[model samples]
Target: MHKRMAMLAFIILVVAWGIPSAKAACSTPVVNASFGSVTSFAVNSTASTSSGSLSVNCGSSLATIFNTDTISVRLTASTFASGTQAIMKKVGDSSGDNIPITVCLSVQNCGSPMTIGAPATTFNSTQLSIFLLTGGKNFTIPLFFSTQPGQTVAAGTYTTTLSFLTNWDICTGLGVGIGGIQICVIDQNGSATLSLTVTLEVTNDCTTILAPAVNFGTAPLLSSFSSVVQTISVTCTKGSVYTVGLNDGIHAVNGVRNMASGSNLIRYDIYQSTTNNRWGSSIASQRWSSTNATSVSTNQLIRNYNYTATLLSGQTTPVEGNYSDTITVDLSF
Candidate 1:
């Protein structure tokens, strides 16, 4: 009986020693945040908004204990040009300039001037919580950014790298970084950068609206020196210098421009002023040149040039028919 009792006690001790501990080993949470390329922000834009998504992945160990975990992301302020959080030209630029822009996690939270690299306090502000499932959880975070009104920058493809930091809770009812909480930074993805690139594109643009054709209506074949005044309207970037040139008509001989009717030709000439100086196709002999300064609005600048065309008097009288000519107008900036 004594031997049996001793064996039973040994068996109980072995069974107790083989049992696993109640406290399970915790695995570090895995996190990955990503966003697509933002849409181009236009220069001189009053207001614009762009959106993207962030993805977060949690490990099985962390998911087993907690059904939900909190995460906080912070955007580090840009260091380009006076520490402004703006985009800069990536190539072919001598001046290292930045385009001013405003970024936010949501439209309502914009323009608050929150410090970069600072920790987000509340989920409504910049922090969000993810709900874990049986195996694990994949969370999607939405991001939004807006640009300041009346912002103008240089013309180029601007780019900037935005840095983000993520912090999450490891255990149930435990706040972030409280009582051995875990934090996974953007660079924790093993050589995979956790960053989003913000891009803005600025282009120098101009639009030209030509006036209706000048009609020297229904004149007799013997009519001498018929003339008409025509105008050309142009709108270009503010402070942009541009020139307008009118090419010689289809019927021309050795730079002498003319108009035509079927096989018949009528000699004519285009002049920049009433003084009758001929307007040529070359830039040096352009009909009009000016620096655009007339701002019709914040986004538009307008300029007008007047030209006169005359029918030469020495042409022999020809058969009466509809006469017309097409001239190619060239605008150079």
Candidate 2:
């Protein structure tokens, strides 16, 4: 009978041990887009014309060399969209200093890889022909080159480039815009334009921190005690040390008191001194430092310190009155 009972208990324990446990849920997010490999569409012309009731009044010298005049490309990625898409357009010859040029772009339904080119007289290719210089918004885009005040484009080549990433799926498309350029001299015109046939991916999500200011209250001290305790409290970042000291605020508490001294007596007996009197002339008088107090920190309600007061031997027992002193507290990071 005993052996049968033991076997039954063992069977119950085995069944309990075989029971399955519940699983915990995970919190990872699903990200499914790449925006790092996109490039800006190409700018065909050196000067772009705005559609928004704007005009360009190039002098006779610039007008004559409109085709061969030195032009540069520039780009700015300020336009942000919802979801995960961002556009950054770069123009060729972006470093041409002091000279202004116009730029334009067009978007089309690309089949696979994307391609952009100069304005065509007629629609011959499968891609749509977007006229950047013909018309549209009156916004003016400016491009320039760095040069000595009066020196012109010193008979050389110049260019600029721009690129952007799609916030959603990696789609080959052109960012629309009417580019402009700036100029200080007009000698020989040599320009550079960018090609928008390549694709790139991009990323733009990040994190940051925030901090608040510290506020303080008026501090008070005991007026009669030379060795008084000043309390201070502050809030700060975790695992960081905050140091506070006196001398930063006004001192209000001051004064001193006399202490009596005595010794032990017979068995189970306690002898004390209760004698009271004015400042005496033997030994020393109760004295204290007039300036520069001390500071300390701990996990307690109050901190105490011993200060030497001008002690007068003839002075009798300390007067039976409340004595206090005041000090300042300074807080720092």
Q: What tens-digit string does per-residue lDDT give for candidate 1 at 14-47? A: 6435543422332333332222232222345555
Global lDDT scores for all candidate models = 0.54, 0.22
Report the Cα RMSD per candidate: 9.4, 33.1
Error of 2 at 255 (Å): 13
Model 2 lDDT-worst window of ten: 264-273
TM-scores, all models, native as reference: 0.52, 0.18
Mark the regions of model 1 whose C-alpha exceeds 4 Å error after superposition. Answer: 1-64, 67-69, 73-121, 124-142, 146-197, 217-226, 237-243, 273-300, 317-321
Residue 234, candidate 1: Cα error in Å is: 2.2
lDDT: which candidate is best? 1
lDDT of 2 by residue, 1-333 (tens): 888767755664564355322111211111111122211111111221221111121212212111222112222222221122222222342323222222232212222211122222111112211211333211112211111122122111222222221111110111111123322222222222222221122111111111121111122321222322222233222122333333311212122222222221111100111223211112122111112113222322122222222223333334343332223333333
